[model samples]
Target: MRADAQRNRDHLLAVAGTIVVEEGVDVSMRDIARRAGVGLATLLRHFPTREALLEALLRTSFEELTARASALEASDAAREALVSWVRECVAWTTEYRGATELMAAAIDEPGSALHASCVTLRAAGARLLVRAQAAGEARGDLDGDDLFALIAMLAWAGDQPALAPRAEHLFDVVASAVLTGAGGR
Candidate 1:
């Protein structure tokens, strides 16, 4: 793609992401085009359909999350590293608001672009969980699916502005319970 075309696509993705988080996935392409300061044709060229755009926006967030998770040094204190990574994931999900929902929807829809993007993050998180458990820093019984479920739940809870204040506390409680079997001191 040409530099200008790439710029236009980037702009569209940014604007579409904000709109999806703030408004919803139902927000029109025309609105995204307007927000991106681009024409409808340009928006369509970048993202042919609502699902395509939504998937692209969500894929971007998930890719970033995977990158962050992958960058975590496994050589560090396993428990601290796992906890820190989870907290960072929570923060990212909270900041992105509707990201969890988008991911869920994508997963539910077969052959989704977002579904492919999620695989790496899931694998990375599983690795972290396994390392933590093997080191006796986290509960051996806690599986990757459980951790993923917890993340989705917490992310959904954090989506509500009223519950936002307690998001960190909630994450801490969950992390402590999962890691220490009871709760962390």
Candidate 2:
């Protein structure tokens, strides 16, 4: 991409990210273009679709979380690492109002724009879960998919105005349930 084009794309992504957090993933394309001080055609040229724009905006975050999981994997406390990663994932997902639904759907849809990122993220979490389970820190019955579902569920709760107040408590409950004997040590 040309320098100017890349700059425009970056600006649009930054604007879109803020708007998505404020409004939602379903916010109109026109609104994003207006907010970015660009024409719809220009915005469309850079990101042909909403999903494309969102994929670009969110891919970096997903990669960061995945990298965080890797870093956490090296921690001596496996259970804490897993819990921390799960908390981070849920927090990130809740940042984008409608992202949890998209992530859940994208994980199952191979052709979705966000599929690869979501899959990699889930795999990263899965590795952490496996590590914890191996150390008898997490429940043996829980797998990556279950962890993914837990993330989505927790994120959903965080996104809700009513449940937002209880988000922390619910996270503690869910985390405690996932951990094994005596809070999985």
Candidate 3:
């Protein structure tokens, strides 16, 4: 991409990020284009669909989270690593307001633009959960899918205005439930 085009794309992504945080993943393409001071055609040219735009906007952060999981995998404190990754996932999901819905949908739909990222993220968390379980720190009953559901549940709690105040407490509760032995870290 040319410098000017790259700048234009960056500007669009920045505006879209702000709108996504304020509104949600459901915000229209037209609204994003208008907010970015660009033609809808330009936005569409760069990102053919809403999913594509969201994938572009969210991909980097998702990649970073996955990498964080990989880094955490190296830690000997398996339970801590799993809890930390779960916390980070919930935090990131809440940041995008309605992203949990997208993630939930994407996980089951391989055709979706967000599918690969969502699957990779789930796998990363699963690896952590498995590590914790192997170390006899986390519950043996829970699997990767269960871990993902917990993340979505916690993120949903964080998204609700009423529940937002108790999100941290709920997180603690959920994290403790996931971990075993010394009552989790």
lDDT of 3 by residue, 95-123 (tens): 99999999999999999999999999999
lDDT of each: 0.76, 0.95, 0.94
Q: Write candidate 1's Cα lDDT for 1-185 as tens digits.
A: 99988888888888887887678666889998988888999899889988788777777667777776667744576777778777777776766656777666655556776777766666778888888888777888877667776887888888887988898888878888888644461
Q: Where does candidate 2 clash, by residue pair?
A: none
Off by over 4 Å in 1: 108-110, 181-185
Error of 2 at 57 (Å): 0.6
Q: Top model by TM-score, which number? A: 2
Model 3 scores a C-alpha lDDT of 0.94
* Candidate 2 Cα deviation (angstroms), residue 129: 0.2
TM-score of 1: 0.87
Winner on lDDT between 1 and 3 is 3
Q: Report clashes for each candidate as comma-separated counts.
A: 0, 0, 0
Per-model TM against the reference: 0.87, 0.98, 0.96
Candidate 1 weakest lDDT stretch, 10 residues:
176-185
